[model samples]
Target: MKRFCKVRWIALLLLIVAGTAFLSFKNSDNRSFQLAKNIDIFSSIVKELDLLYVDTIDANKTIREGIDAMLYSLDPYTAYYPEDDQSELEQMLKNTYGGIGSIITWNTKLKRSMIGEPYEGMPAAKAGLKAGDILMAIDGQDLEGKNNQEISEMLRGQAGTSFKLTVQRPGVEKPLEFELVRRAIELPIIPYYTKLENNVGYINLSTFSGKPAREFKQAFLDLKKQGITSLVIDLRNNGGGLLDEAVDIANYFLPRGKTLVTTRGKIEQINMSYKTLREPIDLDIPLAVLVNSSTASASEILAGSLQDLDRAVIVGTRTYGKGLVQTTRSLPYGGQMKITTSKYYIPSGRCVQAIDYKHRNADGSVGRIPDSLTTVFHTAAGREVRDGGGVTPDIQVEQEKLPNILFYLVNDNLIFDYATQYCLKHETIADAQHFELTDADYADFKEMVRKADFKYDQQTEKILKSLKEMAEFEGYLKDASGEFEALEKKLQHNLDHDLDYFAKDIRNMISIEILKRYYYQKGSIIQQLKDDPDLKEALKVLGDTEKYHSLLSPKATADPAVAEK
Candidate 1:
């Protein structure tokens, strides 16, 4: 009787699956048969693998691998989130977490976990854990040779709980222990803002999460109180977040009922238009929107809308092209699926989605839409704009690529180590915008780098490697050995000479890292603004009101947007 009941249930499942396939294929018998055949084949394969093949198959891992391969054939944005990742997903939307608020790094040379910098007023800061403190143990558990991720997991916990850790300070011989009670760390969304020269306000909105528009409103009001006539909204590395906040920010410079964006999908419910519902805070204020390659999604929406209406002058590189919108659906257990639901279009009727995921290449790889496929669209002021990609700035400022050594120094924490040493000696320094390391200070830093045993590959080394590989592939490596060896010897980088050769670049980086210990993110921003090209360009344009208005106004005397080469 049990066997008969099991057979009946199996039959019911197959009937339901066949019905689903029939409906999906629009009643096409051949397609429906093909779908059933594939399902059967797949099920048989899985069953055979689970029962007969391998010593012991990990069912969950195997199933997830299959699911990942299927999803890989789709767009990058469409993804499946397991239950373990739900917290991270929630934190992205809410921007709050329970942890000992501190940035950490793994010191490869020392083979120990180290504290990078503690967020001001948080657990780590309150515990007197300074930057460069080596985390030797947490909760009496040895942290020697532990990676940053392991140390971070050890540190993070629920609010109101406590974690014990021992850190080795630079001057102190003995390890200092501290028992820090955890709390919900709410990181500042608006990290830095300042009233610049000529009363031009600057607001660097790093993320769009948890009522950022409200924070922006407060920043705007503060700037207005300071008698600022113009504003620069910097969105250089903002990878974007909540769409509602983006719409709210757009509403600040636009009137009620003005359309901001629209989303369209296969379903009717997904088709919706988002318009500004509130009156503008300041409709007449001269504004400049700054963006770069990392600016995307909600950021693109905000920048694109302003440009479409000719409300603000955009200054920076081309933005990250991302127009597809995602929505989450509850999966079985506690897992959730974040799937691409629709594609959003800005006010100019241009979809800034660059990649073509649906129509894959012959090799099943996705390719970005070619420039030839991009169509021209007219803005509200009759200015020409392009669809099928991201927003292009009115005044483009190309970022310079620093030397590979500079990157290695920063990435490998050589600069960080020197900054920590500098901090121990000096309690304070000059203001962020006006601070520069002296020649003596730079000399000490170079000595520190030498002691740290840092080795970095130069771009010339990469070229040499490629040359050697080509010579070997062409069967001439034996004959070319002498020349290759000579080339390698000639290209050898000296740590001593590199310090002075890239002195200016190294100085700027070391200054920023050192200032962070004193003033946090605000310090970094303040220091950067002193030599920021985008800010300079914005200031120049704002100073000349005629040029600023000409960029926005339909009847222009001269075009401010430099044509793309």
Candidate 2:
């Protein structure tokens, strides 16, 4: 039956190609032939399938699937926004969506869905759904068979609509049911802020959404009331949003009329300069900006401006070199195209564009600027800065890469599943600020691992197994079968060691997941801070005034030493 279906599809495809070729050559100036021919061909195929195909076809859904498949070949960022999804697309760009307001990931091992951080004040939080809750079912339908997109569509709806979910709590056998009314989940530009120490304030800015300048001003005002004298603005993994918001944020921290950035393009009319207004916030406050490779666009703008003016020390890995600016234009349908308009340059006369996208290799892959191609520009204090891709942090901090075993553990949700089990067994844990995983708990987790079906693929296993099979087939194994068997046992033992030997790393994962159930998103972050290398470095820089300023100064290019870690 499937073979027959494929044959029909192939026949239809050939017809479409032949028809397209005829229209292309037969009518050079016939817009009607171009549009009408394709439309007519598509209509005929659909009609034939509806009348002759054995299975019933949903015309609307089939058309949508076809359109989606066509667009999927392009980059993920470019998509077809169907009429039904037009409003959802707008909300995504505007940084708001209507749903339960929790990030969820499927745990295939657990045979359920694990909840991530819930946006504060949203339906999920209001209904008492905590992070680490394994979602078993939605509206009485088992979620085991549904994909992420399918579940997402089910969870989202118009505001004020209600949905019911059954969740298996970490420490409980019975699934808990909750009824939640959906609402618009609005993500603030600043989601988290607090005083790190007696005098230093920490603020995590995730996006440059509209009115972010006002939001930052308000956040600072509130922090000022708490006696914040120094500030740590974290922009790690911030992909950026509105360009105007970036300018406004820079204006808040910079001196008036200072050139923050400028944009240039092929068209002279589109080129413009962005500067800070005369009215400024407290410039005396010591500031430290944290960024990583994921920080681009507006995040880069803020970091670049601060570094250029000597206002703040930039720390962490190089920023994502996205200097291109985009503007949205409505298409004929409800769809819109967000096309690149220009490339933005920071104050040092250097465009923080790392990749030379206009120039491609023979294989059409974009190339990053070579060290020799990078141009140097001066900061406000004559500090030399370079432009090519992303903004290079003044103080470079090395990020630790996760070990392969830990990577699989996290990605496979074994860590999350065990954490859920731990939560189910314990009703109450100590306050997140003081809670620590005990040796006894670790023992129980080890036993849990023995019962799990967790599997990992390693190169040694592949090579050893392949060699053993080859030897046996070629009659060479008769001479050394015993040795081969011994080696196989040792390989399996090593595989076992990767799971048990990395107990401390595994424990950290379980601990964080458990902590989040009671303390929420902020709780996990606070608890993890004791061992966070980046946070420790931020604290050290904020504690020392001379070190902070020197790091921002371009002349201070000495490699920062790694202490212990």
Candidate 3:
């Protein structure tokens, strides 16, 4: 009877396995059929449109648009690059391009393409191009009516190629001509690294692209040489790049053969476990990683893995959770498709993907996973963490919201324009770290605004207008007429008063812009550090050894009362 029972179990197992295999085969066949059917339908529609459309349809554009729409439904990162757009893909991955190394913007008001910012030490800046210089022609080809992208394409070429550029300066009467040479402009991975007060080293990692690990290691070593006792890796605004680079970076602080992240997907063969392959440079160093909402992907991986391993104190706000991993597949005819292949789980076995793109809302919108729904995980030290959101900072420092007046000034390009004019008048200024816009300079900026006839809508005024409209519709306007009139008078936006009220903030913005004109990106960072709230908090945490160590302790995070304190 026992033998019969064992035989029966084996038979049932075999039957179940056969049934599953059959179902899988059927599903695969069905998917193939559906795919073929859709392709046929798409081809037929395109053929019909080509044959019967009233206007001449751009087949390539239409097809590309269709491809884009399909990919858009999946996720933002999953993208298709046509043959012509391969340069853009390369720039994104490699972060290197053969160009004059300047940012251009289409000045709608001026109806010209303006040099927004010329990178320092690049061909454009070396050739005396300044911010607000209007591009009239490139290589003698008229840039009139050309958009920023078109102008950019014209600027970019093979390294060592020469081009003649003509630009109208803001102060100059004649159009200045310059013969410029395009060079391989590689954006800085670690833009700035320095030893701060109390032997705390700061490394501002702008991106993870193109040998960031190697560059970051060098920066760290240099900081060590400068006698840095602790390190702060600023991953703020770093949207992330190569996965391997993130792994390599994490390896610098983790032991060999320790898992950093694991990617799981439908294709089991491609699922991977990324580990620290090298011996750590400093495993015992007090590390603080600065992250904000803009910090994502590989940035999250570095931050999350560090947090999970209890290796570093993650400061600032929550990270921009993007746990999805993308892999590029070569397409037919010199094209490429970057497809979202897998979701990655950090060391704590938590996928920090905040949005559920698969289960989108009825309105075709995606929402972040709420705090209530996030599942509790724990760090290596048994500190309670959570998944389905972002890497919550060990010490949360909320970013200060800029005043509305400042926003309007920036949006209207008033600050930028003032800085451009200031640059024209002044040949030199104090270094980025010490530069300040004087009270007299502020007065000049205000005068410029007045002369420009700047106007901006106040949110309060818009809300009041809406309230008045609602009151009228509800038959309450007659009763509240006096109150409405009073509100209107009280809420009236006074430009001069607003300007003075937000002068400090405005001056700071202006000073930073002016500094950029003189010192470039690194200078801007140096200036920003002088007044950075996050950096201040990070310094505080690093300065206090007891607090830093305690924050990483399991008991501190596990106990709610202690955590709150």
The candidate that achieves the highest TM-score relative to the unseen native structure: 3
Pairs of colliding residues, candidate 3: none
Residue 84 in candidate 1, Cα distance off native in Å: 3.4
Estimate candidate 2's alpha-carbon lDDT, on a 0 to 1 scale.
0.79
Q: Write the per-residue lDDT of candidate 2 for residues 389-500, one digit (tens) a residue.
A: 6988877888876656777777777777677777767779898778999989878776766677666676688999899889989999999988998988877746467757
Off by over 4 Å in 3: 1-15, 556-565
Each candidate: what lDDT?
0.88, 0.79, 0.91
| Candidate 1 Cα misplacement greater than 4 A, ranges | 1-47, 144-146, 362-364, 464-492, 554-565
Candidate 1, residues 392-413: lDDT per residue as tens digits?
8899997877888998998888
Least well predicted 10-residue stretch by lDDT in candidate 3: 554-563
**TM-scores vs. true structure, each candidate:** 0.87, 0.78, 0.96
Q: After superposing candidate 2, which stretches have Cα over 4 Å from the reference?
A: 1-80, 110-117, 131-144, 166-176, 266-269, 459-496, 554-565
Ranking by lDDT: 3, 1, 2
* Candidate 1 clash figure, as a count: 0
In model 1, where is the ten-residue run with the lowest total lDDT?
556-565
Native-structure RMSD, model 1: 9.0
Model 2: worst 10 consecutive residues (lDDT sum): 70-79
